[model samples]
Target: MYLTQGLHRMLQMNPAALATVFRGRRRSYGELAARVARLASGLQGLGMQVGDRVGMLGLNSDHFLEYMLGTWWGGGVLNPVNIRWSVPEIVYSLDDCDTRILLVDDNFLHMAEGIASMAKVRPVLIHAGDGPAPAGMLSLEQLIHDSAPIDDMARGGNDLASIMYTGGTTGRPKGVMQSHLNLWSSAVGRMAEHNITPNTSVLHVAPMFHTACMARVVTQVIVGQPHVFVPTFDALDVLRTIESEKVFDILLVPTMLQAMIAHPDFGKYDISSLKRLTYGASPIAAPVLERALELMPGIEFQQGYGMTETSPVISISGSENHSAAGIANGRVRSAGRPALCVTVRVVDEAGIEVPRGTVGELIARGPNVMLGYWNRPEETAEALRDGWMHTGDGAYMDEDGYLFIVDRLKDMIVTGGENVYSAEVESAVAGHPAVAACAVIGVPSEQWGEAVHAVVVLKPGLEVSSEEVIAHCRQRIAGYKCPKSVDFVNALPISGAGKVLKRELREPYWKDRKHGVN
Candidate 1:
């Protein structure tokens, strides 16, 4: 049940097999295992304890895999920072979790100093980039070369494995604590649903910090398959890598899939080797799904649905649901049945199970569910009630046991596959000096399934333009969480309790949409 057990199994079964591929670099299982052990030793040298949190601020690469395995091997928990977050946000996470060791790649090296300066405890930085280590930082290569190989610490079961931070409703990030068993159960459940082919290569185009992508990483390790990585999601790079690497599987959000299919040079690549395409983070539009099926006729498309709290897998719509027959029957819209390890139900506010076709909050109880949010006992209790994780998502279960998500009860917006809490955005918008009051809502968008839109009430004498408001928000929050558009209004509709009526603000934008969410 230990996360690093897969590495040991791979070493015993196929030591010389290709384990990781990134850029022009490739590492065999033997080499990867040895390096991981050495990296574990290095962590111990840097004062990492059995339950210490090790953070990585970087892109998807072979080194990222090493860091994950090495941390577990050293008996340290993972705290993979969000790359899109600003330095203040990053510092907040590091400070919140007391992360004292951070690995930074070239893309994030510039922010390391700022993070270290702002953090309550300045983290020891390890350079994980391809180039030479900069001044005042330890090199990842040097650490592996200098340190002796160490045995796996064998931390497993309920031991904390990762502390992934997700957008919070209170305008901050909440660290979701996932145990080794939670991750193992999730990966195993997914494998049971759709088995991976032997010796196949899986592409890592999605951000490694994300729970969905990291779960796939664990699944690949368990299956002992080759991992092919791209630093970031670029349509051309993904197509080229698939053709060059002979990739068998990939996980993408609907937006990334659409971009790849719509790319002008997409037809030039020989991507017949790809066997499976798993998409999630947001529901795919029918037209986009149709186009993807038409473009990649051989590839099987599957949809997964969940949150960071569920170890990122609650249900998965199989390839069959994406088929023409399933679409005709309208089953394609479902999030599919609960995973093998999970028990899912739609329940009312009173915690009673609702009848089929009744819209209610989706709740799940499973081994894969996260332990709780770090340092937030009250919030944890509020989310995990009666032994079931109350997912703040509005969904309905049909007679066939399929779940259909209609809205996000938490007022969370999924724009370009990234969760943006309306409260978080509203807080930033209201920070502007010219603003009196503001309400943020998700508006229907063609490019990004849902775009963050803000309704603002300016002060009596002050005025601010849309661009100015957006610029102001950029200083306080991530770019993705900033409002895509802003509308000046006299006043927002409010309930008797002094809360903004978001539905009224969202109504015009989602007028003809069947679901409240895009």
Candidate 2:
């Protein structure tokens, strides 16, 4: 099924119903559909053909969505540029995809010009931001207003829909190719699993370039839910929106949540209107969860677990699992039951299934799994084999089917010849009163080959010593897994998606020298 079919259905059901509220502009499904259609026609008129790759470089905006959906509607593949990436990183993705039409917002106007200089094929430029379009670039409004609506679905089912570039520890980014079917089923399956209905209003705070948040947007369209969009996430702005706009639900990573609650005016916001807060992209500390519960007793926290390749959702720890009853034990730490359409298995090094309660490599098989890695057949074969997508994450399932993510297979530390899941140590350290956030990494040690190191962030006005931190962790976990050394930072490095950037944290220690991790 075409992913854009929701737009047509929404327009038919309620032409006047608000479909998007972005940057003080409200567009009903009727308005959104018309713009999307005309924009598709505009791209087609500009020589875009079926299977052509179209690159969009911009921050979150209505124009970005219109351009993306329009490109897909015209049977072209979307290549959304990561806004946080450097010029070279952006160039790599665009050049790798062989995209020829670069749709740029004001923020990237200059960068787009620089990219144009290095492109294998000269790219046609379309400007898509407020005020006057760039002098040398084609104006988006001009293109849409001058063209006729085109309704064509040349690519469907397993056809390439979009290519998302995820961070590559391999020294270069890899494009994960997702099909129309992959996306549609991800949206439908997640919606069905979460009970996200027309009455639900999802806040768009995470960057649109992220497949996790973008998939949520697609689901909103299909369910005809009103989406309240923000230019970017600001904790105070988010609280204000919830109080004034009565936002029912939102999604964010744990780091974002930690910052929000830690904001000075956090207690001042009226947040009783919120119902579900879906958290993912990183693990959340139990202390943060406890504080959030105390501050907003009415909220239900749903934990999401996935990587970009699985359309970013393998399971969601739902409302029932977030209850006070579930928090007493370690149940709150679980990532919840797998989504209806997904099958998860914890496998050993030999590719044999591990029993429940045994930690092993997490493998998945579902429609939500991507078609393959873009233009990398060997890599694709390696990633998607034996009828399952290997997640490269170590995890286990309880008898009740609750998934517990142990650690990334690459991130698991081998210290003193003992296997240690960094997540376990981080979770324990995070439970301490003085610790606000932390990252556990393996550092070089002459004695142990690799020693466990903890980089921590403490609560304001708190005095904590590295020795005390080590002692606290030592009591909770094996001494080998506990921090042999600790560094107190005001904040840990975080990625564009808001997850703690463990790789960046480890870079200081491992940059000039190398260990095993690729």
Candidate 3:
């Protein structure tokens, strides 16, 4: 169950096999293992003790993979910072977890100063980019080159492996604490159901910081397959990488998949080697799925459904459900049955099981379920009750045990594969001087699956333009969290209890849609 066990196995059985390929830089298993060992030793040399948190604020790269394994190998927990978050959000997350070592890449070098100044305890900044280390930052290459290789710490089982932060309902971020066993169970369970083809390389287009992609990294490591990476998702780069690297498997959000398929040069590359494609984070539009099937004939398609708290996998709709017959039968809309490692049940507010076909909160129990929310006992108790993780998602189960998600009970928005809490956006929107009140909701989006929309009521005798409102939010929150559209209204729809009626506001945008979510 150790995270580094797979690496050890590869080193013993196939040390010479290709381990990673990143933009002209490739490494064998033997080389990667040596680097990970040295990186672990370097962390130890920098006074990183067991159970200390190490954070990385960087885009996707082979170095990101090393940092993940290196931290665990040195007996430390991981805290992968969201690259899209504003400086304040990044600082809050780092401070919340008491992360002492922070890694920054070229893309985020400008933010390092802000983060260091704002964080409660300044972290040791390590430059993880390919370029030379900037002033006041330690070079990752230098550390690995100078330090001696260390032995594996062998921390596993109930040991805390990562503290992934997700958008919070209370206008903050909640760290989901996952154990090594939790992650191991998830990857193995998924691998058992959707077998990875032997000797096939998996492309890493999705950001490695995300749970979905990180879970894939674990699965690939367990199978001892080569990993290919691009800094971020670019349609042409993905196509070119697949052609050059012979990438056989990939996981993408519907938005990325749509962009890649809709690219003008899509047919210019030889992607015949691609075997399986998995999509999730948000539901896929039928047209996109159909077009993908048409363009890439014989490729297996699977849709996964889960969140960070469940080690990111709860159910999977396999290739069978993507077939023409399945689509015609309406089974393609399902989130699929319970995963192999999970026990799922739809429950009422009182925790009683609901009848099949009735939408209720989705509850699951499994080793893959996260241990708890870090340092938030009350929230942890509320989410995990009686040995079941009560997912705040509105969904229904059918007679055949398939789950169909209809709405988000927590009022979270999934835009372009990123989760944005309405409360967080509303808080920012309300900060405007001319804004007397505001409510944020997720609206249907053709490209992003969902877009954040803000409905506002200006203070009496005050006026604010939509552009002004959006510009104000940009300063307070991440650009993705900023409202894509702002509606100036005299008053927002309200319920008897005085809470803003978000459903009413969302109705116009989501009307006639099969599911409330995109």
Worst 10 residues of 3 by lDDT: 493-502
lDDT of 1 at 301: 84
lDDT (0-100) at residue 224 of candidate 1? Answer: 92
* TM-scores vs. true structure, each candidate: 0.82, 0.96, 0.81
lDDT of each: 0.88, 0.84, 0.88
What's the true lDDT of residue 288 in model 1? Answer: 62
Cα lDDT tens digits, model 1, 1-518, are 99998889989998999999998899999999999999999999999999999999999999999999999999999999988778998899999999999999999888989999899999999999878999888999999999999889999999999999985334578999999999999999989888779799999988899888999999999989999999988999999999999999999976588668868899999999999999987555555667688888878888889888999899988988888898899888788889998999899989999999987889999999999999999989999998899988888899999988865776878899987767557657766778767778888889999999999988788988999999999998899999999999998774321235676788788779977764
* Superposition error at 216 for model 3 (Å): 0.4
Task: Report the C-alpha lDDT of model 3 over 478-506, residue by residue, as the tens digit.
Answer: 99999999999988764211235676788
Give me the runs in candidate 1 sitting further than 4 Å from their true place: 412-518
